[model samples]
Target: MPLKIYNSLTRQKEKFIPINPPYVGMYVCGPTVSGESHLGHARPYITFDVVLRYLTYLGYKVRYVRNITDAGHFEEEGREAEDKISKKALLEKVEPMELVHKYTNLFHWAMKQFNTLDPNIEPTATGHIVEQINMIEKIIEAGFAYVVNGSVYFDVKKYAATHNYGELSGRVLDDLLETTRALEGQDEKRNKADFALWKSAPQQHIMRWKSPWGEGFPGWHIECSAMATKYLGARFDIHGGGMDLLFPHHESEIAQSFICNHVQPAKYWMHNNMITINGKKMGKSYNNVIKLTEMFSGIHPLLTQAFSPMTIRFFILQTHYRSTLDFSSEALVAAEKGLKRLWEGYENLKKIKEENFDLPDDNDLDKKINSLLDELDEFMNDDFNTAKVLANLFEIVPVINSIKDGIIEKNVLSSKTLHRMKDALTVYLENILGLQSLSQNNETFDGVMQLLVDIRKEAKSKKDFFTSDKIRNQLAELGIEMKDEKDGNISWNAV
Candidate 1:
C-alpha cells in the first residue's frame, strides 16, 4: 500500500506524492524559544521525527526544516503588539537574546533526550530579518498589505475579496468579523480580521529590528512564512505543526505566501493533536504543564515517579498522532511496564542461535511469522499507524519467548525466517520507532554490583544470614533491586 497522510487543508486522507520525486522537503514549526519546553511541545517533534525517519527509510532524500521563533512575536493577536520574549526578559531582568539562548539550548537538550532527528536546516527568525522584510515588501508592492502608522497589516478584506482568506481554516469572513473583538489597533485596520505582518516597536522594546516600516519585530505569523519559504522554497512537500496552530498561525502563512509567491506553500498540511493533562489541555495558564526536566526528575507535583525518556516516547506512540494523548501517571507506568516486557523479549530473541537443520515439520508457525513481519510495513504505510505496528510486534514477543522456553522447537522455523524476524525487529524498534533500552550498563557500577553479589553469595554459602540480609536491605534502600534467579544467580537493576 502507498503512504497516506491526512492533510488538514483538504480535511481528508490523501496519498502522499512528493512534488519532486526522490527528493522531499518538509517544514515543521519549531519552538518559540521564550521558555522551557513542556509536554505539549514533545508531540510535534516526535511525530515528525518518525515521519522523517520513515521517509528516509524508504530511500527518499529528505531535507527537513524546523524553525525557531527567536525574534519574539506578540502576546495576543488583536491586542497590543508586545513582544513575548521582550516582556518575559524584562520581568526576569535580562537581555532578550540571553533568554533566547538559555531556552534554545534547553530545547535542544530536550530534543536529544526525546531522540528526535535534527533538521537539515534550523533557521531562526532573528537570523533571517532581511528575508522577512523582503517578503513583506513584496506583499505591500502586490497591494495586499498596507502600512498604518509605521506598522504593516495584511489587508484581509482586500485579499478575501480576491482569494478565500479563511479557506485553510474553514473559517468564513462574515463570522470572523462578527467574532473578533476590538483591540488597541483595530481602528487602524480596515477590518477586524486583518492580522499584522509587522508591528512598530516602541523605544522601550529591546528586541526591535530596523525594517522598512519602522523599528519593530516581525509578527508571529510572518516569521514562519518567511523562514519556510526561504529554506523550503515557494512550494514544498509537507508542512507540519501542532493542531492548535491551524487557525491563525498556519492560515496566515498560507495567505502571506499566496500574495507573494502565487502558489500554496505546502502540498500537504499535517498537524498532530495536542497533549492534554488529565482531561484539560496542558498549558502554563492551567498550571498543569509538566516540563521535560520535571518529568525526567519526577519533580513535578503531579508525577508519582520519574519516567524514562523511552517510556515517555512509548506512551506517545501508543496513541495515533491525530488523537489527543492524555497524560497521566497511570498511563506512563503502563507504558514503562510494556516497554520493559518488549525489551526483555528482544534480548531473549538475540539468544536464539541459528541451527543447521532441515525444514520444519509444519510451516504454520513460519508462515505466521512472515505474515506478522510483513504487517509491520503494512501498518506503517497506513498513515503511519505506529500503534498497530507496536501491537503486531508485541504479538511476536510471546512467540519468541515460547521458542526460548523450549515450548516450541527451534527447528520448527527455518534459520532464514529467524534471521528475518531479528532484522525486522531491529529496524522497526531502533530505526523507525527510535526506541532504545532504558537500562544502561555502567562498567564501574557493574563491577561494584558484581563484587557485592559475590559477597552475598559467599555469605549465603557460609550460612551467615545476617550479612546477606544486611546487604540486600541496604541495596534495596538505595533503589537497587536484587533478583535471585532460579539457577541461583543474582542480578541487580536500578529501580
Candidate 2:
C-alpha cells in the first residue's frame, strides 16, 4: 500500500504523493535558540527524523530544512516587541550573538544525544535578512501589506476580504477581529487582527537591521516563510512542527506565502503532539520543564535517576506522535527495563544459525513470524505508527528467547526464513528506529571491567571472602551485575 499521512491542513489522512517523484523536500521549524532545549523539544525532531529515515529507506532523495530563530522573534508576540534572545542576553549580561551561540551549541548537543539527523540546510533568521527584506517587499508590492510609522503589518482584514485568512488554523476572521488582544503596536495597526511583518525598532533594541521600512527586524512568522521559500522553493512537499505552532506561527506563514508566491507553502502539514506532565503541558512558565541537560544529569529535583539517551528516545517512540506522552519517573523506569529486554531479544536473534538437520516446516509458526516482520512496514506507512510497530516487535521477543533457550528446535524453520527474520529485526531496530546501545562500548572500559572481574575471581580462589564480597558490592552499587556460573565462570551486565 502507498504511504498515508495525516495532513493538518486538510484535517484528514491523505495519500502521500510528492510533487516531484523520488525527490522530496521537508521544512520543519527549529528552536528559537534563546534557552536550552527541554524534553518537549524532542518529539518533533525525533518524529521527523524517523520520517526522513523511512523516506530514504524507500529510495527517495530527501532534502530536509530546519531553521534556527536567532533573530527578531519577540517574546509574547503582539505585545512587547522584545526580542527573546535580547531579553535573555540582557539578564545573563552577554552579547545577543554570544548567547545564541551558547544555546545553539547546547541544542545541537542534545539533538546528537537523541540520535537525530542534522538538517540539510539549517538557515538562521539573522543570516537571511536580505531574503526576508525581499519577500516583505514583494508582499507590499502585491498590496497585501502596509507600512505605517516605519513598521509593516499584514492587512488581515483586507486580505480576508479576498481570501481565506485563517484556513490553516480553522479560525474565523470575524472571531479573530473581535477578540484581538491589544498589543504595544496596536495604535499603528488598522485592525487588531493584523500581525506584524516588520516591527520598528526602538532605540534600545540591539538586534535591529536595515529594512525597506526602517531600521527594524523581521517579525517571528515572516522569518520562517522567508527561509523555507528561499531553500525549498516556492512550494515544498511536507511542513512539520509541534502542534503548538499550528496557530499564529504556521498560520501566518501560510498567509505570507500566499501573498508572495501565490500558492500554499507546502503540500502536507504534519504536527506532533506535546509532552505533558500530570496532564498539564510542560513549559517554563509552569515550572514543569525538565531541560535535556537536567534530564541526562539527573540534576533536576523531579528526576528519580539519570535516564540514558537511548532510553529517553525509546520512551518517546513508545507513544504515537499524535498522542500526549505524559512524563513520570515510573514511566521512564519502565521504558528503561523494556528497552533492555527488547535489545536482549534482538541480540539473541542475531546469534541464531540454521541447523543442517532437515525437518518438516512448522507452517503455523513460520507464518506467524513472517506476518509480524511484514507488518512493520505497514504500521510505519500508516502515519508512522511507531508504537504499533514496537508492539509487534515485542510479540516476537518471546519467540526469539524461546529459540535461544533451546525450548524450540532450530531446524523447525528454514535457514532463509531465520536469516530474513534477523535482517528485519535489525533494520527496524537499528536503521529505521535509529537506536543504539547506551552502554559503554570502548576497549578501555571493557579492559577495566575484565580486570576487575579477574581480581574478584583471584580473591575468591584465595578464600579472601572479605575482598570478594567488597568487590561484588561495589560493582553492584555502580550498576553492574556479576553472575557466578556453575563452571566457575563470571559474567557481567551493566544494569
TM per model? 0.94, 0.94
**lDDT assessment of candidate 1:** 0.89
Model 2 score (lDDT): 0.88
User: Per-residue CA lDDT of candidate 1, range 282-375, in tens?
Assistant: 9877888999999999998889999988898989998899999999998999999999889878877887887835666248988899999999
TM-score of 2: 0.94
Clashing pairs in 1: none
Tens digit of per-residue lDDT, candidate 2, span 267-370? 99999999999989988788899999988988888899999888899999999999999999889999998998898788778877776335444577788888
In candidate 1, residue 125 scores what lDDT? 93
lDDT of 2 at 316: 93
Candidate 2, residue 250: the lDDT equals 94
Candidate 1 worst ten-residue window by lDDT:
354-363
